[model samples]
Target: MTTTHGAHGICLSLLSSLSLSLMAALCSHPALAAETDSAPATRTLIQAGKLFDAHTGKLRSNQTIVIEGEQIVSVGAHQDGKPGDTVIDLSNATVLPGLIDAHTHLTGEPKFGYEELGISTPRAALTGAKNARITLLAGFTSVRDVGAPAYADVALRDAIDAGDVPGPHMIASGAALGITGGHCDNNLQPYEAHAQADGIADGVEGVQKKVREVIKYGASVIKFCATGGVLSKGDDPEASQYTFDEMKALVADAHRLGRKVAAHAHGGDGIILASEAGVDSIEHGSYIDAKGIATLKKNGTYMVPTIYLNTWLLDNADKIGLPEFYLKKEKAVAAVSFKNMSNAIKAGVKIAFGTDAAVYPHGLNARQFAMYVQMGMTPAQAIQSATVNAADLLGWADQTGALDAGKWADIIAVSGDPLADITLLENVQFVMKAGAVYKNNVAK
Candidate 1:
């Protein structure tokens, strides 16, 4: 679990070069050969039919993006080209900044039912790698992996970053912090059986210790179960798990360490407590009331309503192989997710894009876009939640979310305009992350 950070150094460097070559081959057109030769030595021009400017929410027409190495040198009307550049002609497709998922567990674990009968850290890591590739191909170039057992997500994040695996740029939380018997604790069998999860901490002092421990072990963000969750057994989803004092302690400790806190809260009391505690974002505010929403709004807390998980869970419950108690819990929560999220959105609460991805399947993260639109957000606004809003919440507004000069060259292309039909986002035809192309639909 505690491996060296630079283990895959050689592999990642080679993968980076391969990523560039793949894009060059895919975007090169015979007719554009002269333009390519005249371009900069390491520039790639992307001809976009329609581009979603996440910064302005305005779709520009007939745009060409200039990329040099892992940064966007310029994006707009064509500047003159230098020699030996690559040109990708997506003149038939609509282009948008790569999508971001704020809450995702890249490492696989049964969301409901089984609890943790036969799972292992290595198995979870492999599953995470697979899911990461699927998610990247789906157009999510960046994701914040919230939690996994034994810091598995940290390994996955490094793997993807090192090019040992193809996946989204990740901000890994390492593990979620929970009080003993709280939602994130591995409360599989009775307490007499075994205390397995490192996440379980108790009281203000304990939570503060846990926060420091996780950060020391390489957690980029900190997560806590402020309330009971739908998948955990024996806890009422409406019950607040941690006291306000405990939450305040956790948030203050994480923030003082320069880390943001994501609170997993369902009940109204917990949501309000987390908001008031200065957590950066609240996850799954299923039982939020008007007062809770107001508190979140007034405090500038972002809500990551994972609306799609309920539908996916109900539709594929049998495949999940959960224990009977967990299954019942999923059934109970599934019935109310839509209404809960819709009301939250209608209330004008600040929303960031998050999908409880492991609860459903991983690659299908983009499916949440249409659900967001159905929940009263315009397509443009929904797209922004996954882009600009998510970036801002992650404190990466300067680097990743939008397509602009001096930002990472993370971009994706689709066959149609997502602004007109948000469903088009579900099928990302081309994917490029940090100037490397992992998927190209236009390639022969």
Candidate 2:
């Protein structure tokens, strides 16, 4: 009886060893190994009560957006959440695509005028980290940061991309290319100070080289001063800075390197020159005239009207300690900006939403939507300028203009229909970007 028990135990041990070897062989096979090693895809279900169809500029009721990882798998009528899916219930709010701002300066804010002289590059980057969160929570998931001193915008963008900081998806243009003493230059100090902005370049060759330089330093887009600016010292906003030949060279080099160009043009001649030179967009366009409007339309150039800054600056100039020099330019630009912008809108020129955020404050970007409507755009058109138009301008039309399938899941929600009351956007209650919820006040 003992011998028979020993034989049975040896047979059981051999069988267990054989089973383990067979399992290992199967797992070692190429196809079978991949199947066993792969993890299940993560999914997040969003139940939206009224989803705004950005493509049609209409609302669809009772929608479910299926998200896997960071992409939207599908959007259809309401469906029950599957097991193992994280569900966000925005059933009581109005859901829309996340907003975009074409012109922003995240690295710095209006520091009560000349106090900006004391801000160093590292300090600017730290300030950007704070403003990035504020801007993201305000429902602007993406922004085109037009210019930052010393490549601070590039560093900020990299930090955000690495998940080291919370911020919007940034299309950063390092230091804006400018001619000597132009709006993009540092003109505050005397000649003895040897103050020069990194973007300062001289003639056509110099401008082209500067374009390449900024792009090499991680500029996704090239921004050049086509005209002077209101905030800068010792330059008239209406004066043309970069000549047409130089502008053409700058745009050519930027486009060759696969980077779009934005021209800071607030004068009629500057706008025309920039449009004819093939720039993608014109920032400010404060002094755009009939000829300039025709040129922009003919070239299909977008005009980013940052009209809201005028009101904000005028109202807060004293509080901000804005120097009389800058204040005078602001008043001059503000005087004619509204009429020209309204005319351009009425003439059916292409428009993209840009608030010039740092000129006033971050997180107040939505306040510009109401101003767009007042400037002759319908509420739907105004919203589309930020979504469709801005996306097209940024060359991200396929990635995130709307909440479509196979797109990044960037979405925002307000309490009511923004079409009925555009001002509702100013108080976004829920915000989501790339399938992650950054702000969700609507959820109880």
Candidate 3:
């Protein structure tokens, strides 16, 4: 059975790669192209003056990338081209792979509370549809939405895959699980309100059941609240929500189902406990300590330090209309989160790109790159967090991590060299996903 499955996987990947190559050849036939001169043309070749590869941390100059549909068949000079073949001259701009954000909440808007309560599941899907389009245009070709209400993220992911919506390739966790009155649960009202979240499960049996239910509902990943959160009501950010046994069940079940687990843990004990449970990644880690850092490193667990959300909140909290409790929680957690993240980075734990995008606006996900650079990461290291490392975490390393041959043509360009000034990522001038140009602001 294992051998059969392995063969199946290989065949699937080969088919995906071959389809792009076939499309590129079919789309660029000079004779067929001239015959259909009245029709629109797809890009066949891209000339890049400078390329920043996240894998090598070096900038190469004067390179050619040949795209066959959505995949790059070759990355070296290939002057032989049929007539009417489309060429994109990005010699004036620095090109690289499209950005990936491993952490996002497309369905949930910026504010959460009474306003969030009012939004039904269908409304959440609608919001995801809008946010997904904006995120894609911002040069994030792929994103993993870790949490959403009412399984709305499932609907959104399907819609995007079906071409019913314009968005990044998405891996969606249908709903984030937690205990009663914990971060992922409905804490705004009493149980009498009948507003309990589907994720509010307890004990090993309870969490196991919930994990299976979420997977049954089409969740590509499993997200469980290991610790309390700042945005949620009636929970201290420093407390653990799931016990070790419960977390173990969640992880085991999720892995058995072929899904990775992302633990939303802030407190030190919770991070440590979640690591012990074999959770694939730790989110927030606001109060992570030396012990927690060691545990993460020992387990090879990835840390998704969402440092920018707190900073963005601190800057715009007053305008966002956060409740008083949330304001206090934000202030308390922001500094601790930053300090812990700095410590974790120094500890040398594996890290990935994950901006809690719904906490701020969706399109501004690239802002996290700047914060990563601020936290002791070199410019290339920062870029890798959103490309190579992020893609590895998302299991898309084969398809979309770098601008290499046989990978998806998810490319972006910036006017300035990000190595010289990391802040240039904030302004993505060009975006091409799956061989389709979504935004091109280059000057003629």
Candidate 4:
């Protein structure tokens, strides 16, 4: 009886061990791998209550956006999602195309006198990496980086594209062209500092060469100073900098290379000169007058008014440690910067959204929309300025801007209707660049 019982127990143990081994094999089976490693979702349906149709200036209702990978595949009425598809509920939010800033300096941080000494090209790229994330979180998914030192903008742009860092879809102008002592030059430093800027040159031929050099160094667009600026030392903000012939040469070279030219112009004459010279867009236009507006309209030139910078400077000038010259220029420009943009709108001049971010702060870019509304732009018009208008000016209208089929999935949402209070955009509740959800806080 003992032998029989021992054999029975050994047989039972063997059976149990066999069962465990079978279970292990089952776990390793390809069909059952899902129990240990789940497959990533391939499709997601975003249901929203309101979506802005940027092209038609209308708000869509109860739309379902289907995202497949990095692009929005379809958008229509609610659909019964299939198996393996996920859903994100933004039914309480108002969705819009992700905002675009027509002009920016991703590497430029707010600086004081002589404090600029500490910033090197590598440091500038690092700052750009940091600011790029901040700007992206604030809902500026695309930006045209008009100027940076040492191709810092280009490096940052490439890094973002390679998934090495987070940032906007950047169109970088490696370095801005300028006269020897113009706004884009290193005028603050002494002549003996050996600090002559990279793009500084004189004469029409010199400017043409510099324009070509800027393009060769990875500048997608050409930026030049058409007039003196408020921040540069020893230059009159209202005075013209580049001659018409020089400006003409720069624009011709840039256009010939298939690059648009953005001129930093302030005075009306400078604006007129640049417009006639065939520059594509004029930045600032702080002192642009009626004649300049007409010229812009006639030549189909776009005005990118960074209104909030003047206001920001005026509000914080005392605490900002600006040089006396900057303070004086800021105060003077503050009185009329807002009005110039306002007049441009009234005169039927084309407008594009730009904040000149980093002149005040990065994440505060949405403040420009409110400033635009105050200047008599309807909320739809203001949003269009950031979306369609900006995209058109950047020469990316086919891919971005409107939240339509075949467009890149760069979209954002806010809790309330921005059509009523444009300031709601300042607090973005959701952001999705290229269909990847980076932020979401819409109740559900």
- Candidate 4 lDDT tens digits, 219-266: 898988889888878887788999999988888888988999899999
> Clashing pairs in model 2?
none
Better of 1 and 2 by TM-score: 2
Model 2 lDDT at residue 434: 90
Q: List the residue pairs that clash in candidate 1.
A: 12-162, 38-81, 38-82, 39-82, 39-83, 40-82, 113-322, 113-323, 114-322, 114-323
Listed in order, each prediction's TM-score against the native is: 0.88, 0.93, 0.89, 0.90
Judging by TM-score, tell me the better candidate of 3 and 4: 4
What would the per-residue lDDT of candidate 3 be over residues 235-311, giving only the tens digit for each residue?
Answer: 98899989888899889999998999999999999999999999989998899999999999999999999988887
lDDT of 3: 0.88
The reply for model 2, stretches above 4 Å from the true place, is 1-22, 25-35
- Cα shift from native, residue 418, model 1 (Å): 1.2
* Clash count per candidate: 10, 0, 0, 0
lDDT of each: 0.87, 0.92, 0.88, 0.88
Model 4: residues >4 Å from true position, as ranges? Answer: 1-41
Off by over 4 Å in 3: 1-43, 78-80
Evaluate model 3: give its TM-score.
0.89
Best candidate, lDDT-wise? Answer: 2
Report the Cα lDDT for candidate 4: 0.88
Q: Supply candidate 3's per-residue lDDT for 50.
A: 88
lDDT of 1 by residue, 104-206 (tens): 9989744554556577899889999999989999999989888898898999988888889999999999879887777887777776887657788888999
